[model samples]
Target: MEEKILLKYIDVPDIEKIEVYQKHDGYKGLAKALKQHKPDQIIELVKASGLRGRGGAGFPAGLKWSFVPKDSGKPVFLCCNADEGEPGTFKDRLLMEKNPHQLIEGIVITAYAVNCHQAYIYIRGEFSQAMKVLEQAIEEAYEHNCLGKNILKQGFHLELSLHSGAGSYIAGEETGLLESLEGKRAEPRLKPPFPASVGLFKGPTVINNVETLSNVPHIIMRGPEWFKGFGTEKSTGTKLFCLSGHINKPGVYELPMGVPLKELINNYGGGIIGGRKLKAVIPGGSSTPVLTAEQVEEVAMDFESLQAAGSMLGSAGVIVMDETTCMVDALANLTRFYAHESCGQCTPCREGVSWMAKIARRIEEGKGLEGDLELLLDICDNISFKTLCPMGDAAIGPVVSFITKFRSEFEDHIRQGRCPIEKDKSIKVRG
Candidate 1:
């Protein structure tokens, strides 16, 4: 069984409450850190643990934290990117809704490490339940003196706030999120002054994913060596995989980082829905490339392994597709979403995304032009690595991957003027 750290008390009743959470060694790590360890010591412990950002990027948390300028005569900020906007990703929502205090403890310790006086939880607008839960948790923390002035009598003052985004996918980007939080339009800003040195109203800032911060308390309590024992040398820690799509059991599962993809499908997900044979899978959310059944066998659920298999472990949203699924239609559906969500800031992402969506819709609906395939790839070439933020790259990920991996399916859709399988049997269309 995978060792549960964040979800250790997953089944405990009322784990969202401070009282219940306190009974289960919840704020114990915060108490220990505030009392026993200095901010530098806590940072060192995290650096040794090898924990990466759980929110798609997989960047090392400690390295990211280390970038904050210590001597800057400004109050630093920590913003939790709780905007769970990625399709098929609800793991953060699950964490927030079930155990908001666990995340709160993490925020307190991380604030101490980075010397951030003020913090904000930038939650998604759609996650009303998660917002309510987090608000309640923050209130509870304030009530118990876990937050605000002179936290735990350590002379470390912190004020945590909750802010909700207007449901823009671009806001999920750190710079874009900063812009939104500052009461401006949500759009990606230029880098180099990066969020570390300058962010959130011209102050040094640190933004962490909800799941990433939730691990801090555990890493401190369990020690780095113990934390490193569960996963591979490089990818050390359990990962919360958002398993969905054409599966018998589809939900957020906390599994060891190196667990095989096949194991997650069979052992944890109970195989594909209706016991159908697996055709392809979006190994990590809608933004990642889809993997054919043959390619998924040798893959492990970590950053490096999936990248090696011509895909990314983005958000770890495992969207499984059975044999009866249509790749063109799936790509078209996902393209539609990207098209709708594009912030219309960069011309390439704003304009190029619409092109891909149109071309994909044309192909999926059996109205594909003769040169549509080449045109789709051309659009992808212009979009990926060209736009302001990764929204452009994310928009092209599925488009290029679908054509590359499932070329036959896409071609068949054009040739047959309909999904080939759908001609004989009914096929489910998924976004």
Candidate 2:
């Protein structure tokens, strides 16, 4: 395997403990940040490293931090987005479960660099195990003086809290998370005032994904040159890819950013399950557009490469499918999820998602009429940029991609009034 940066010491004994973590160079970056570098220096180092958000958006981390007004006079808050509610994505869960202090240390270092004294980790409500683990880790940080008051007597006072969301998928969005953190209904806010300028109680806030912040200590320790040496020039460093679906070995794998998709499937994932032929894949998470088996033949798994291939490396959740899987059924299942997860904050998302789900379900059930395919595309077109948040666009991505890529399947459903691919009662659609 490629070099393991984030998951290097993940299997160490008692790595959750501060002393054990310290033995493995944990908090070394925080120590360096407190003593040697100023806040802007850290931001410059991040900018030089070319680190991007590991969240679905993949925004530049340093550019994002730079947007915070230094002289706004209002207190800046750094909120960690731990709401890993994306379908087929579970890499963040492993990070929090095995190495909670890693996240804590990353948070402290980021808060220091941003001149923020207070931070919050908005974790998903469903991850009860991860929440308990992080809470214990936070208490341990306080005990070790790594979180509260002056840390290592360097005059850096940071207060970190663990806030849990109400199991709403919309809360994973940055503005939606901020709104939910304030005890309001989980929904997205408008742009232009963006999170960097106006966020978390109308103060400057830097909201970063758990994986994004986790890269900070490593960057501070290894330097920008070292971090940029691995991945593509535009998309640097390694990424944690959450592999799921019909692959033989379905789990999370940390790899260099530009590794080819075929190698990840054939070598790391041990190829298709039951020796089945590959069918289709949702290159990233469910929200990203799907790719055919031929499309995944030789594409590199990076932000640029995937985008070049008409998809994205979003959240790096690779959902594979075999020849037996029906595209219509798969899209129907995905649309159902987005439909249910919609925050109902906008007309296109609120009403459009449900309409897409109903249409997909009708087609998957072999009741599709003649104009169903175009109608599905039309609904997606209306929902694309018409909603308050990206949820509307995200909801429509799969519908459009599946039909556009595999028009034959939807046509077969309409023509035959049943799934063309025969299946026994035991074999169900892989959602």
Candidate 3:
């Protein structure tokens, strides 16, 4: 209900300008952090604030910062995962486009806190305008001596670079982003030798989501208690929720973590478009399972609650579907995306996702056999855990959930030789 912290400067004209951003108390966080707080003290404050990663994984920010080997003696690298490639998610783009300096300031403060000498902002290749805005803002920060060596006369030095990804969803994955940054193919590396211990050229590094790092300025400026006052106990601070599809006011809404899904849809989203009845909602991004309208009432728009409801708060991409939307067709759409996006490094993900997509297409086209549902489930089950990355499991979530929650709709397609909802229409065949 309170005014948003992340979205506070969103509506300000010329928010990219250092002057405008300074007018809104932008670099105050960095100044406070450099002049007063020790890097460890800042990390301690962030830990006390209870800020979790907004980058879909829901990892604690302070815990992640602590993962950086404090005495590695190597130049620590801080990378902001700004590849906003998740389907039904556009909040990061807005943040970058509107308040570029906020993100940069956050990155600087975070780099200082983590003892990183260099940082990179990995922007999505498709986001040319966002890149331009960020570049201009970075130049201004350097001009003000807020970025380069001896920032605020505190003797801390940091170099920042803006690298554009070659357009892949998997690149949003932390390890994959690192590979892409290294000018290699974007493929996820194994964890444990996780990014903290060995990342970005086998040095100690910290990779954070765009929105997660963007909150650092606020956390430093207002103090940990001020930020902790916003969201729930565990999920502290505000988040940008990207609401889309069938919603009257479909756009990004910055709200607290524990806000109810119903309130987000009805109040902030202005309910369903055309006043249609809400059938289902994907609380997170495309990777998460759909929540029926009834289920949305009880779920809070946070990480733990959504996970408890058999879904995740993935990037906070809330895609609302109306009654007229067909579950089978929707799942087919999402599965096809994953199938096309799969890196093909692992057999289960590469082969299984493509197979599932083909079967889902056939089922949607009404040519599916009686045993096809079981086959689809089998393929999804096979691919869920037998892959190198979460992509395989994420790709299978909607397929398995669709068949489980709306089995009758899939069955109707097989029995009736066309989608039951669109019975009069011809089924489009696809391989």
- For each candidate in the order shown, give its overall lDDT on alpha carbons: 0.89, 0.91, 0.89
Model 3: per-residue lDDT, tens digit, 230-249? 87887888889999887888
Listed in order, each prediction's TM-score against the native is 0.97, 0.98, 0.97
Q: Highest lDDT among the candidates is held by which one?
A: 2
Which consecutive 10 residues in model 3 have the weakest lDDT in total?
A: 422-431
Stretches of model 2 off by over 4 angstroms after superposition: 423-431
Candidate 3 has an lDDT of: 0.89
Where does candidate 1 have its weakest 10-residue lDDT segment?
A: 422-431
TM-score of 3: 0.97
Provide backbone clash counts, one per model.
Answer: 0, 0, 0
Per TM-score, what order, best first?
A: 2, 1, 3
lDDT of 1 by residue, 286-395 (tens): 99988889988889889899999989888999998888778887888999999999999899988988888888888878798777899999988988788878889998
Model 1 RMSD, rounded to 1 decimal? 2.1
Better lDDT candidate (1, 2):
2
Residue clash pairs of candidate 2:
none
